[model samples]
Target: MRRYTVSTAVTLCAVASLAAAMGPASAFPAAAPPAAHAVQQQPAPPVLVDCLWKPQVHPGDFMLACGDGNSRLASLRWSHWGADSAQATGTNLVNDCDPYCAAGTFHSYTVTVRLDDPKPWAKNPKMQQFTRMSLVYTDGRPDGFRQTMTYPLWS
Candidate 1:
């Protein structure tokens, strides 16, 4: 047999011609059209689960101390509530246990709150909740706490 060599471009052109000969419809199946009555549903925004395991969006007040009400967020005004993150300006109400936790004094400090790292909620797998919380104390922070504190949010 005589020596024959096929170039890469020639092979590609041969395959392309074959595909084109078959027509676009035969080469690629048409996608099914959406139903006429199908209503597009927007996904729910990211949320925070409260102490009682309740999903909350733009909550006015959320208790940080789930057990004893020692620390909590109050008067929250959310500036951003998106799919990836959320932010708010609020007051961190921390109780100072002068005598004891039972007879502690609650103090309010201005704070900026940020929520991120959204994932499927543990209790409710269908919904998404923020897994990380960051607080920046604008005025003052609680004793034995840093100015900027980052905590893992409860699922």
Candidate 2:
């Protein structure tokens, strides 16, 4: 009886090991690529125009799309605005960090963005620009946060 039990236990262990090495069977079919004609096409490019004033109530949010795909204002809210400048706050989402930005993790910082008066764009006489932007962090600033950014309004 003792010999029979030992042999049965050894046989069961060998069968279990073989099954583990073989691995489990797939439950689903493999994925197939879409046909050339069936694949969706890219959309049209964004229209370039003068930046017009879009009304927003106090503490309203907005996004700034920088032409260069690396950086963007994820969201912004104005606390106050006057003829010369506007006091606002927002998150700057950037993809230009170390170790390469694309496919890497995007970092976000809580910031205060000061939007100054529209200045004439030298390249285009008819276009106006956001003369300056000052970004201040309330907290959680990434190492790359520049306190201020000046520019031609890409958004």
- Which digits, one per residue and each the tens of the lDDT, describe model 1 over residues 1-155? 12234566678889999988887776677787987569877789988999998999999999998988999999999999999999999999999987999998999999999999999998878899999999999998889999999999987
Error of 1 at 28 (Å): 33
> What are the RMSD figures for all models against the true structure?
15.5, 19.3
Off by over 4 Å in 1: 1-39
Residues 13-105 of candidate 2 have per-residue lDDT tens digits of 999999888767664456767787887775322222233443233434444543445655656666766645677777877664457655656
What TM-score would each prediction reach against the true structure? Answer: 0.74, 0.47
Model 2 regions lying over 4 Å from their true place: 1-67, 96-98, 121-128, 146-155
Best by lDDT: 1
Per-residue error for 88 in candidate 1, Å, reads 0.4
